[model samples]
Target: MKRKWDSSDERYFGIGIYRPKTVENVGSLWRTAYVLGASFVFLIDAKYKKKSSDVLKVWARIPLFQFETIEAFIQTVPYSCQLIGVEMDDSATPIQDFFHPDRAIYLLGSENNGLPKSLKSKCQELVILPGEPSLNVAAAGSIVVYDRILKKVNRSLLIQ
Candidate 1:
């Protein structure tokens, strides 16, 4: 990729995975986003070798925004998009039970604490993927993206 921001806005199904540790995981998510056609990525406390470098080569061509906190980032997203938080909660709906909105922003929490309680309050819904408790952050993100894309591609069949 040329590593330049594309004029085209990120697709309708774009995702915003919250603060993640390890560039490797971040890189992997970026790759997934690229495959999923995500418009851009927002990083909080993300370590960068350089603002623009080969390490960020995956996201170079994509629109990448850096923020100090989740609160700030969420403010920037358009109100029209549904902000979803992926977490393990008593009331969390299964990821499969829900339908992906035309404009959705899936929020992936950190590895240790999951999503902050305060932030979770803002999500339109909280979801949990059916699996072992050990699902890594990157894998969780990939699953959400895949699920949404599947629903989106099969919308016609679903209606019938």
Candidate 2:
């Protein structure tokens, strides 16, 4: 039987990078995502080499989708999922203030250049982590995921 989606029901989220520059970062992010309950991980316009940092072999536990272009990635976003872009843009909402959606795909940009205007335009919301100099892409993604988990837990506590 098909079940209807409910906001209070189990929620799922995924995190990914756009044109990621290093294999180690990808592996680290993948490991963290799996540990933090991400339903999946993905890459857009990038490829990753196997890295030892991913000792958990998270790839076997969760799915990783690779898309050659932003459009391709956008097309595959699950229905009712929001695209939350993590960036340092001035207009972005601080991670602490941003209420994560029940279903979301968090997209982080490449380490050096960050997300392009074309891609940022497509994001439903842009969020910024707390920091001055830019953070490593993997680290930024980890923080975002951690924030989401933390907020979700806090909300659940309130409800209980």
Q: Give the residue spans of candidate 1 off by over 4 A.
A: 1-11, 49-56, 157-160
State the lDDT of candidate 1 residue by residue for 28-132, as single tens digits: 777788778777766765554432434546656676677787668778878678888888887789987988777777787877677888889988999899987
RMSD of 1: 6.7
lDDT of 2 by residue, 1-160 (tens): 6878544586899999999998888888998999999999999998776665566778899988899999999889889999999999999999978999989999999987999999999999999998799998999999999999999989988887
lDDT of 2: 0.90
Residue-pair clashes per prediction, in order, are 4, 0
Q: Return the TM-score for candidate 1, rounded to 2 decimals.
A: 0.82
lDDT of each: 0.73, 0.90
Model 1: per-residue Cα lDDT at residue 112: 68
